[model samples]
Target chain A: MKFGVLRFPGSCDDVDALLAARRVGDAELLWHGERDLKGADAIVVPGGFSYGDYLRAGSIARFSPVMESVIAFAGDGGLVLGICNGFQVLCEAKLLPGALLPNSNLRFTFRQVELEVVQEQTAFTCACGLDGPSPVVLSIPAKHSWGRYYADEQTLADMEGRGQVLLRYAPGHNFNGSSNDIAGVSNERGNVFGLMPHPEHAVDELTGSKDGLCIFASMCLAVEAARV
Target chain B: MKARVLIRPKAGILDPQGEAVQRALPALGFEGVANVHVGRMVELTVEDASQIEPMCQKLLANPLVEDYEIVLDT
Candidate 1:
């Protein structure tokens, strides 16, 4: 499975995401201005201060030429994963259900967090068989100020009913004060996924936890299955 | 025509920045404050006033997290 990691002008974690994707399969960098996805099986929108976080996080980057392609790619049931600021971009593009607001404490924060896989059937978390009967929890790092997940009560209910929610902070680990402890979510169709946490940063066991690979490995299997 | 777009946090939405500002006001001796909410204003001159509303919906604000008002040169 080949993964394409997008790089906007101020994308600080683009390379890290690319390196993490390479752990599972072939991966390369795709510029924000890219018109074509270069035949990547899956797309990863990496985290960063894209467009210098001007106006709002991911608002400007959402208009990038590459996103047009990403939108079309996602519309076709292709696998797409957005991490950190990329999740913000997906929200701005209306690819995801809710918008991420500022952290409740109004402070930028980053730390290792415990996230539970709320939905195991989605393409993003199907490989998360982490020695659990059900409801697998993984240790990952989450960062940024605008990571508070928010949706109206009705929308939240609809998403919950549809199993669109993919991950949630485990109990007290709701660091950003996300709605319903939601740390990650997928679109209604389940092909597009977004997470406020940095799974890429957690790929190396030397750094602390290798739990992120399960998510990436999940995507690899998704792409592989699609090609079959 | 000159128009201003008033974009405010939607009612029932959490505004941490506004809450922080409100909390700090009492310490500075500015009491009797209530509903201290902050918002953004966008100024523009357009040929047609009708287009301004569309602009606000498309770019000036995020509908899910914010509410925007259009005023003619307010």
Candidate 2:
């Protein structure tokens, strides 16, 4: 499967994402504002200070020309994954369900975070299927001043009821003060996934952990599943 | 026409950046600063004021976590 990693002006993790995608399979980096999705089977928006986080985390980046194509690509059933800053962009663009606010601590927390796979049906989490309800142990670094995720009670309930809550910080251990401890979520279709953790950072054991491989691999499967 | 857009986080949502600014107010020599709220200021030149709504909806503010006000400068 061909993977397209977006490279915005200030995107810090574009290379990391490219490397991770390369490890998983064939991949290429697509510069932001290029006005095209390049026919990528799947697209990954990596984390970074796109537009220097001027207006908000992802607020400014959403207007980039690349997003227009990304939106169209996602609308046509192409798999899309947004990590950290990318998550913020997806929310800003209304491609995903909720918004990411400041972490409750109001501080940037960077460490090995544990994420529970709330729903494995999304193309993003199809690989990590642990038996029963135990949360999956994946080590990924997150660095953002506004990483808190928020949604109204009713909307939150609906997302949960519909199995759209794709991932969350481990129970009782949410690093960022996200409502419902949600770490990630997908739309009703489950084709688009957004999460706060940096899955690209975890794809290689040389950098840190290798638990993120499943997520990228899962996206490939998700694309193929949609085709079938 | 010139317009100013004020974007603030929605009520009940946490604002860590605002909190940081609030904490620094006293250190900056403001004793009466009991509260500090932060928002964005975007200046735009539009042909007609009607474009403000769509601009705010599309880029200025996220309806899910923030509310925005557009003021036209006469």
| Predicted candidate 2 versus true structure: per-residue lDDT over A1-228, tens digit per residue | 889999888899999899888887788888887977777899998899899988678888887899999998889878889989999889888899888877788677888887878777667887777443445666677777777788899999999999998877876658788888888888888778898888888887788788877799888777777679
Q: Under CAPRI classification, how is model 2 graded?
A: medium
Off by over 4 Å in 1: A130-133
lDDT of 1 by residue, A1-228 (tens): 899999999999999899999988999999999778999999999999999988788989999999999999999998999999999999999999889999997889988999998888768997888455676889999889999999999999999999998999998899888999999999999999999988999898899998888888899988888779
| Model 1 chain A: worst 10 consecutive residues (lDDT sum) | A126-135
Off by over 4 Å in 2: A130-135, A226-228, B16-36, B44-47
Pairs with steric clashes in candidate 2: none
TM-score of 1: 0.96
Native contact fraction per model: 0.80, 0.93
Q: Which ten residues in a row have the lowest lDDT in candidate 2 chain B?
A: B30-39
